[model samples]
Target: MCGSGQLAVLLVLLLCALRDVAPLPDSGMLFPRESPSREVKELTGLWDFRADLSPSRDLGFQKAWYKSRLAETGPVIDMPVPASYNDITQDPMLRDFIGWVWYEREVVVPARWVADEGTRVVLRVGSAHYYSVVWVNGVKVTEHNGGHLPFEAEIGDLPQVHMMAADGRAAYEDVYTLPVGIRTVKVTSTQFLINNKPFYFHGVNKHEDSDIRGKGFDWPLIVKDFNLLKWLGANSFRTSHYPYAEEILQMCDRHGIVVIDECPGVGIKDIRSFRNASLAHHLVVMDELVRRDKNHPSVVMWSVANEPASEMPPAGLYFKTLITHTKTLDPTRPVTYVTCSNYARDKGAPYVDVLSVNSYFSWYHDPGHLELIPIQLNTQFENWYGKYQKPIIQSEYGADAVPGLHSDPPVMFTEEYQKLVLQGYHSVFDQKRKEYVIGELIWNFADFMTAQGVVRVVGNKKGIFSRQRQPKAGAFILKERYWRLANETGRLPPWTKYSCLL
Candidate 1:
């Protein structure tokens, strides 16, 4: 698995296992199809394309035609997308050319679509030759080395791009500009510093799951969640088990929210899953993930995996390779993996820059024993810190709360208990915030659908907000707590600090 946590939600990347399956389906293994919630704009008209006829076909690569107007690089003629350039040309050399052919076009996205913070605008190239490299506004977004595989790039709020006529305007064009918020993330011995100040990640773990679209992207749903995040005064969240859409990260970059971009490396529960082949594939996913999200300022940390079988004998070398490889890919940010494994036995713990621990205290360990929360939670922090001395984020906590379920004494699965569960964790966090504990993200930001299991209730009810984005009693509790923390911490917008000049 290559990436996981937004708001601390762990998106289980079951997609990684699909590579091992034979004859993958065209739907998931291929480019996205237009759904009711999604709209597809075709780029199949004539394009400015040219075939490099130099002695070395590497002329385009050397000159970097993708960076600027293809016409400026050389002569160009009309060539159609989704069709072979050889078929359109009358010249024999153009037809017979067995080298790199360059194609470029400027398609203006809809202003409404660009304005919508939730819409993730992806450009899908249906078919291309042997080796294909894609760039959005001159920045390389994706590289595919295989044939017949349709590739696409999710270019969120695409950078300003224009190749105009002599008059400085294309025949038709629309412009949308995005201002980036610049900030730095540092993980020291006892703190998670953003813009050189200790910041607490008092947020919720979130899932992309919803009632109608499921894991599919929906602009309305995404906007509602962003509204809830701001309403709750949460400054940061983990992508949970895997990386979320580029659109969400773009919102974070623009709005000054923090993120821990995780890979799809989940469910390595079996010892056999830690083999070299699996490790090789996992590295590729990280490569793709980093290329897509590396520039987003909101992404402060990179999570390599989530809850793998770290106690296994092979896990030591396996995680060492995985974590180190991710660090090498993007050294700008710290790297981590969510672990529910025992701290002493987890092979990957030593490699992570921060210890993101997932624990269910009173709910799972001693059902309804709220009093034990502080004791157990404190020990959890002390043990991990005593062993590693690294910063810690209570990446996952909180008990499932069935909305409106009542109990006088705060029983499990009730709203009261969920409120108390958070209260219990918060008490411990308040104690450790001054020490090595850097952040605390709840188990869920909202209740989400999951596979039917004994532990699930219709789905997971651990969300402070229901799956519909409506607040539970716990949401109000968190709103007050988070706002207080924000004020006490003097949380400023990320763009306010340009440098360390203070």
Candidate 2:
């Protein structure tokens, strides 16, 4: 109880304060250290999951599943992230029949490594089917609705929000995540905030029917598809009809590819039922998507339906309702629905942030109608502009090229023909139109898988590249055009023809 004793007490207090400030090195796991601030966390490990038919039913997930899945004596099953059940299940359920699927994975953060201001950690999810709710450690940090987009959540601070009690159960905000110094996070559609600012997106229409993976895909194949698109100057990509795997979105975040996430609810014909069912399903997916992907910077738009209700009047109402639902969940991004050529110019079409039209003037209309192509194409853009006066996107326009075919006299399959068509198309786009044509994304970057046996040139040659991901001579022309645009530092002479480069 003398001077030495008081000095010892002071020393102990100082050491405790220092421990708080400089956590042990092991705590580093709590704060993820990845480049670009948006690199997706590798959530591609084992996950305990079970399916539920009634999404509306009050089926408990936190207690039974988590306890059994995490039990020492319980069996450990692998649930790879960025993967779909149908792709792995030998006797998979039909796409429409899949209901609720519960997933349980343990999340951890070392005690010393709590996220400080400079090092913020986020868990990102690429896509979930219909709907999903994520829990970290043992607390629900996020909830999401849509399935086509990405979602994220921050889960670091624990003592301030929750603390371990004598009973050994962690508690916070009434819900719990996992129990490993782990902070729980949940994601929902309304929360997919981008840079704290709502983002408007533009990108290419993507279909996932590959010759290699068919409609089913794994993580590796997904990454390859993404890499191919990035090389072609694509900033954004759409899933077109179905919700893609979570890995695809994760790859986009890593490589800086913005995704326009869509759902699996394509070929939807019945609009009356769709109004109730599709709208609810789309919103749920949006909720999950925004919640999980909110932290990623690459996502910018939400597309609810693609070519819906092709020949139905209620299609208008369905699209209108879906857009409204999406905005309600997350207004930070614009909403769009891709319509067939016939309905794209419909006067009664609902309101949208951007006016998108899918036209194939150069294809199907008449191959040799070079002179008339511009007149017809420009009119479509003008018609949408005259009514909406909103930013217009010539969303889908590209021709198929046969592989191994080169230029001959009359040169139909040669690079010469490809360049000529591109030149004529750009000429039309170059004209001063009333509507603001912000950008144009061709229908695809490469040939995709089509099961209906409707593809040309042994596949959907509509892509500049083929299904093997090979350049079909036209790819060179595209690269040249992109290079010319990138190199235009000043008043460069009206860029020369792409054929000249060859």
Candidate 3:
């Protein structure tokens, strides 16, 4: 058993052979098999919508409101699809509404596009907030939980409506099947494999957070973030606490950025919440997550939960059930839950395919003691490998560095301090590469807004780049580190040349 001090010294010594790595290969098509011969319709027009304010129950879903043309209702109004329901109205109640809201639109399929054995009608939604269910001509087609990405249902042979003379009533019949796609992601005992090649995650953890959107889908923000990721030499990112807008994932697929598709299972701390309602809801979220993202090649893995209470015995069972169900949904990808708990003590660690542990060594644990990070991180990695014998990814690790803050010899929140902290962590990462440690994704790609509190000046300032997507001084340090790692790991393409920032 290596002590903490010995481990730190070993990591420092291993850093002597420091070297370079790059962007991942193109993630291929998000929704593949599209061509000029196929008819693709944009469902971006106004749709009849209403909010269920009963508060006691999900009246819209429960009453099967999708069966009815919502225009027949009195409170219905035309709300735009592919936009957040929050900002579409001036009403504060509607903007802040947390419960069920119904959206309905009538889509007319071109007669020429529908033919027996030759045509397929796939209804692809860009994104919907929270939970959404769809219907076409009084028939419920599909239901999904996540708000960030797109979900599609193949509504085969649009509903046939006929009048029944006996009762003077109309009847409808519709048949549909889910789309089938290929799965190419695999995980070995040593590394994460994509299409059977060892793919290192050179990336960051990000949130779908920005100004005014409040988790709403925004295309400009998506483009900007992708550009930033490219510039930073990062080719991957975890969706952090939840799934992002489908458009973003589509962009990732186009750009070759691998994604760890995570669910919105954040803040699940209490044991009571862990058991009855939360566990059931978690499974639903998992089903929806896989249904929406399983087709995308960029989505390499599923992160079911973020920072859950994994040490608890109940949490072990809770995550075990969730992971087991997730595998059933999409076995092509590995499933993991991001844990902030100690790896040696965490009961939930055994249930996941990969061990993703979040550690804040010098920053959160021994604040300002950067020297202790190497040994401490080494011991933790060794202990986890000893027990589980699984590949590990340092999923979240960073110091909160406010832009422009500076100090000689490095102090907390300064750019210098952030650089040093990352250096320390990277040193251990280099040493542990020979061991089971597989990847390192920093806490954030860029700074983002969090709830207002005394601890946060504006929001979480741990990003290598500012919220506006501008790089801090620490960004250069990471760029070099990532570029070097990519080169060393043979991830860099032959066409690219290595250059240093002077």
Each model's lDDT: 0.74, 0.51, 0.72
Shift of residue 452 alpha carbon in model 3, Å: 1.9
How much does each candidate deviate from the true structure in C-alpha RMSD?
15.7, 13.9, 14.8
Q: How many pairs in model 3 have backbone atoms within 3 A of each other, for residues 3 or more apart or on separate chains, i.e. clashes?
A: 14
TM agreement with the true structure for every prediction: 0.68, 0.58, 0.72
lDDT ranking, high to low: 1, 3, 2
Error of 2 at 431 (Å): 2.6
- On lDDT, the candidate that comes out on top is 1
Summarize candidate 3's per-residue lDDT along 1-502 as a digit string, tens digits.
3332221000000000111111111121235333544445665667777777776535655665655666554388777554656666789787656666666655554443443334456666655655555666666666555445556667665465222223332333333332443448777777877767777787899987665555555678888887667667787899988888666777777677888999988877777768766677677667767876777778888998889877877887888888999999887788988888877678788889998989998888999999999899999888888888889999999999898899998999999999998999988888887767878999888888765688686789999988877888879988888778777877863224434312
TM-score of 3: 0.72
Indicate the TM-score of model 1: 0.68
For residues 378-421, what per-residue lDDT tens digits would candidate 1 score against the true structure?
99999999999999999898899988899997788899989999
Error of 1 at 335 (Å): 0.4
Backbone clash total for model 1 is 22
lDDT comparing candidate 2 with the true structure: 0.51
Task: Please rank every candidate by TM-score, starting with the best.
Answer: 3, 1, 2
